[model samples]
Target: MAEHKDYYALEMKIDQMIDELQGLCSQNGLSNTAAEEVVVTSVFLYKFLSDKYMHNIEKFAEEIGESVDEVLANENDELDAFYDAYPTDVVFHSTDTIQALINKSGQPGFAAMFDDTLERISNYQENDKFKVSTAGGEKEPLFTRITENIIDKSKRDAFAVAIFGIISESKFDFSDAFGGNFDFYSTIFEYLIKNYNVASGTYAEYFTPQSVSSIISKILVGMSQVDDNKLYDVLDCAAGSGSLVLHLANELGHGKFGNRARVYAQDVSTKSTRFLRLNMMLNGLTESLDNIVQGDSLTSPSQYNVNHDPSSGYKKFDYITINPPFKMDFSATRDEIESNWQDTDRFFAGVPKIPKKKKESMAIYLLFIQNVLWALKDNGRAAIVCPTGFLTAQSRIEKKIRQRLIDENWLKGVVSMPSNIFANTGTNVSVLFIDKTKGDDDKVILIDASKLGEKRKEGKNQRTVLRDNEINQIIDTFINQKAEDDFSVLVSTKDIKKKNYSFSAGQYFEVKIEYVEMTEDEFNQKLSGYVSDISRLWNEGHQMEAEIKKDLGGLIYERK
Candidate 1:
């Protein structure tokens, strides 16, 4: 109970900080735009890093029987040696400390000083791994000159000052929260990006809800037989903000196992990559920061080794999770992918053809599905979020993919999620699980959880939120392969092939017909009532037909 109260207090403080920062943006005329999001998130991150740096120093001081003030008073060489010995995830210089910045807040050119400090910290040599790399071989640092976004140079100073004031007043201490579970940090991450994740452009950013992420992680990890002593690699090809992959890491015993899993993620959105980096740091997965690549996973997958004698392109992973963009206008790169990737066999199921109209409606998720299949090892496991329509698709790339899964006996199971599960879009979705270790005789578990969540109004849309018990129920059923009447079914690959490779649970469920016993006298009475009603209806129809004929015959035709 005390732990819950402490977490609630931290949540309130974080929420207050975000609200104040956004309000400051409004006062400075940078509200509800890309600039506002960048400035607010960056400033918030600066404060977090500052607090975390101080927390580390405090802990180190206690371990060595030294005061924090003594450590802060150390010269450049002494401080560098201390950091080298301690080996913290983030490095902070004496001049880059928040106290130094606070002392200089009243000085002239304070805004420039602030921007310079953030830039220096981002460009520090020790922090090189934190930089996100693009497909063009360019690295993006953590922070930019965010104050420049304010058009009025005069207000820039006030803007920076107000941001510092808000952060200092709130005094965020993430020390206790870091020891908390994934739910604690996930809540903060979601709240941080809720406003920016709404509808954007052709590439709409779909942040997978926590319920869906939890279900995927729980089932994927629960069903797999993992070795506690071994280190594993996990990937999320279309990781938006890293929620799915983070949950999977936690399930794999992240903190307890001491970096037991290395998380590799790639996404096409720069904004999402930034958010993903923050999430990794917040969750104590700092070792995986170098694996976070910001590029088009389809056109140029950067998570491969090219330095070996024979380049091992598209590194295979032990586990994979994906929530790819359902549809996008990849028409620009469709031809490039076809011409370049033919030898790789990455798109074994083939790509969606460009339509004459509405090219944006092309099903790009098919490519992601095929990519996941190619990236998995012989005994690997994966879970993918797909449109519900993909389950029952009878032809084209969708059917071909399902056919491959069934023919190879790699399909594990599928769960149909509730409608409006994602508050941003109303399209229903399903999770497709794959396990390469399954044999031909293994039956697939199909669950229809579409009717399990409660409906609630979220902003302008109605969202279906799954309760804790409902999520647990779905996970338990899938992991144990339990077949419930009308809700779930366990089917063999032979039966799946007979059904034209459809993965929908409803198709496999039995259509039960109830029979009742009755006496001969009761049956006769029921038959007589049915015959009388039919006879009366037939007589009424004949009378109506005669009346219609007479009315038509009495009418006279006239031309005007």
Candidate 2:
């Protein structure tokens, strides 16, 4: 009970921090814009990292039998020795502390002092792994000059002071949240980015629902024993806000295994990459922050060039989960991908042809699916969220992709999700699970969970949310390969090929027929009643036809 209360209080405090930061952005006329998102999230992250650093410091102080103040007052040599003995991921200098900044809040150029402190902390030599890389081979630091976003230079100092005041007064201690569960951080992350993740015009953040993320994570990690000695690599190419990858990490025993799995993520949106970085730090997956790339996953996959030569091809992973953009204007790079990498076998199924019109409607997810197939190790598995229609596509690229999956014997199973599963878009989606080690004779599990989930209004959109038991049912059936009536089916690759490589569960469901026995007298009585009703209807129709003719005759035709 006390634990629950503490969790609730911590959640409220975090919410207040987000709200205050957003309010500060609004006060400076930066509300609801790209700059606002960057400012609010950055400041929030700054405070989080600061508190996390302080938490470590307090722990170190306790170990040394000294108060936090005394530990800070130590000479440089003593402090250096202490840090050497007890290593930490985030290192902060004495002047970078929030209390240090609070002391100088009333001084001139406070905003510069604030920005300088954050910059120093981010650029710390030991914290190099916290940086994210761009496609152009440039590494982006963890913190930038956030106060510069304010157009009015006069208000920057006050804005920075207000931010300091919020952090200093709140005194957030995230020590308890270090090993927190997925639900705790997932909720906070979603709420933090809710205002910025909405679909606008063409570009969208494509945030995956927590329920869908859970289903994918559970099904992907099904029945597999976690090897403590083995290091797993998980990738989500279109990882918006890192929900899918984070959930998969939690499933792979993030708290227990503890960095046993390295998460690699790539996305074109810088906003999403920033949020993804924050999410990694918040979830105690700071070791994977360096793997987060802010670039086009389809065009230039930077994860491939992390520690290996680009000529050696992409890095294979133990597990991959992605919810790629369903459609986008990838025409700019479509031809480049086709011409440059045709022989690389990255797009083994072939890329979608660029349409003369509506280039934005090009199916970009097709390329992501093929990339996933290529990046999977021989025994590795993956789960992808794709348009439900892709499963039953009769011809073209979609059918070819399905055919290849079946032909290669890598197709494991598919789960067709309920309608409105995502609150942002109403597109019906299905999860495609791929396992390269599946034998030719292994049966593929297909689940039609479209009937599950209750409807609820999320903002202006109505979405379907799966209940805990329903999600469990889906997972249990898939893992056990249970063929429930009308809900799930287990079919072989040969059967799938015979049906034109369709992965829809409904296609494989048996069409049942019912029969009922009746006595001869009863049949005759039922037939007689049907004939009497038909005769009465026929007589009424004739009378009505005659009346219509009379009425038509009364209406005279007039020429104009």
Q: Against the hidden reference, what TM-scores do the models get?
A: 0.94, 0.93
lDDT tens digits, residues 1-560, model 2? 11366777888888888898888788889988888988888877777776766777788789878888888888586578666864536777778877678999999999999888888887888778888888887888888998988888999999899888777745675667666666888888888888988657322355788888988998888846668778798999989888999999988874354676799999998878888988888887877887888899787888876664366556888999999989888888889999878878888778888899999899999999999998888889999999999999875788889988988888889999999988766789999999887765568999999999999876677889999899999999998899999999999988998998889999999999997799999999999999999999999999999999887777754321
What overall lDDT goes with each candidate model?
0.85, 0.84
* Residue 319, candidate 1: alpha-carbon lDDT: 96
lDDT of 1 by residue, 390-430 (tens): 99997688999999999899999999999989876778999
> Candidate 2: misplaced stretches above 4 Å?
1-3, 75-78, 81-88, 170-172, 199-204, 254-257, 307-313, 555-560
Clashing pairs in 2: none
Off by over 4 Å in 1: 1-3, 76-78, 85-88, 169-172, 201-204, 255-257, 306-313, 540-560
- Provide the lDDT at 485 for model 1: 91
Cα shift from native, residue 369, model 2 (Å): 0.7
Q: Pick the candidate with the highest TM-score.
A: 1
